[model samples]
Target: MSGYEKTVLLTGATGFIGGRLLLRLLDQGIKVRCLVRSAKKFEAMFPGLDGVEVMEGDPARGSGLSEAMQGVEVAYYLIHSMGSARQKGRGFIEQDRKAAENFRIAGEKAGIERVIYLSGLGEHQKELSKHLSSRQEVGKILASGSIRTTELRAGVIIGSGGAGFEIIRYLVERLPLMIAPMWVNTRCQPIAVSNVMDYLLGCLTTPETAGRILEICGPEVLSYRELILCYANIRRLKRAILSVPVLTPKLSAYWVQLITPVPNGVVRPLIEGLKNEVVCRDNSIRELIPVELIPMKEAICTALTEVEKGPGGIPSRQSCFLHSLT
Candidate 1:
């Protein structure tokens, strides 16, 4: 039903954001080719979804990228090295750099037109966590490539099955009272997963957004403690957080691992990232691609509603009514 239809290559089709984006692209009747590590897994996930071609490959390994990117007009780079860095003992910074380089080289060789990347929202002036730093660095590497690139950065994405949101949900639901690190005082602008998908899909039609780093977030800005308390309120639970300066990042990560389903490696980097304030600096993207941004409470409600329906039952952006920015 939308006008912008072209051959697109999605790198992280199996990821949380990428999966949602893939559904929207299909809803718009766009032809998409996905580069995934396993075609069988992708097929199993989507079942009978038509009009999507899956190519087996790993961007981190630099395998099957060119073949997957052939004739692709727009390529969405949503791949990250967080899990590999944390679990496999690989340097996340180096892994991300290598992946971006591989993607850049492949895109240039294939003559791809545009690159859309989702990164973290953090101020460059302040010291950032390795996870956030690596995200920004990947965006830079992708932009430096031959193809035009549009980078969208967000903070604390709240959605069902999302690591950040799940971590928060687990912490609040499992613990009525918590001893948190000082970083709990750090401020962040959380965004809804559906709104993030809207921005990603809208970028395809809006040409001016190319070569720009757009910071997309929810309308409200709240501290980490406030976010947790808000979630507690929504669940009608009395939660109290005691923030202490003595708790180091490592100790906080260990605490998180014990309290939630999040792994130690994953929570360490994520906990470290909370040290810096990650609020939006430039909101110009609001004017460029205007979509109704969901508030934090509504976003949490949506995520919780999806969780009530099991993981497979979680709806995509295409199934829900989305406002058109074009």
Candidate 2:
């Protein structure tokens, strides 16, 4: 399977990370087939892009997936169940498990050679949050099939329109004085969205990534509290953060709902997940990809610029800003 000759089937093509990867692949003359739920919505977002194919399907239902996997050399599984809470009930873990099983069966039936999955970084299964646990479980389900699986576990993705960045940005911009939960003190390693895309694209060509569970992150590590302060300083806003130890996840979610635009479902999982420190434990991926990571300040600046640009989308030259920094 040569890099230039592979036909990659990408799920979650309209998502924050997936959308960026799709454009990069297309630009490199890689054949990309996207599995999207709504063709109309996909067309609305993409609006006449050449050299890409879209197949209408739902990964959750296992419908229309087989057709999309046909003749696929490598399939990128970027779909997550966070936004599907209402439709799948409050326990998203079970929903994720079922979806992964379906995807595995479909991939095997279609003879998919490799399956690349993007997941979250967390401790061992016993100490994992429901969200992080579900991500790991999904990786296992994908590997159960004969197809080789590459699981890239990442922490908060720093990019405009990304849920993590949105939360950090809104908190910094909206509050002059904040009463944050103790989880804010937990350490996290964030990777720029462009860096994430770089690893994803690298997996397509790097056979060493197959059958490996790799953790990816930026050059620096900081506490969630420090991240908020950094963002505040970037925008030149005066702010004071007070971390309260007694605030439970439930209480924190409610407070976030009141203070920010983040919904309860999204905020709840995020808050629960933030209690654990999320720094990379190994540098194996660095050896594999061999690209210098973007600094935190530069990543935040690029994210802010994208948000201010009205989500009309980032220009191609701007898409790989972090790549040049590397």
Q: Pick by TM-score: which candidate is best?
A: 1
Q: What are the Cα lDDT values of the candidates?
A: 0.86, 0.84
Scored against the true structure, residue 142 in model 2 reaches a CA lDDT of: 96
Q: What is the lDDT of candidate 2?
A: 0.84
lDDT for each residue of candidate 1 in 1-326, tens digit (9 for 90 to 100): 66876788998888788898899999999899999888887888899999998899888789999999888879999888676533266677787898899999988999998999999988899888899999999998998967899999999999887889988988887887899889899999999999999899989999999989999999999999999998777776789999888999989888888877766656888988998898999999999999999988888888877877765433343433222111
**lDDT agreement of model 1 with the native:** 0.86
Error of 1 at 309 (Å): 0.8
Residue 127 in model 2: shift from native, Å? 1.7
**Which regions of candidate 1 are displaced past 4 Å?**
85-88, 311-326
Q: Per-residue lDDT of 1-326 in model 2, one digit per residue for the tens?
A: 23577679999888888888899898878999999988887898899988889999887788998899988879999988775644546467777788899999999989998999999998783487888888989999999879899999999999987888888877777779989888889999999998998899898899999999999999889999898888777676789999888888888778777766766667778878988788999989998988768888889888877786765432332433443333
Measured against the true structure, the TM-scores of the candidates, in listed sequence, are 0.93, 0.92
Specify the highest-lDDT model's number. 1
lDDT of 1 at 263: 60
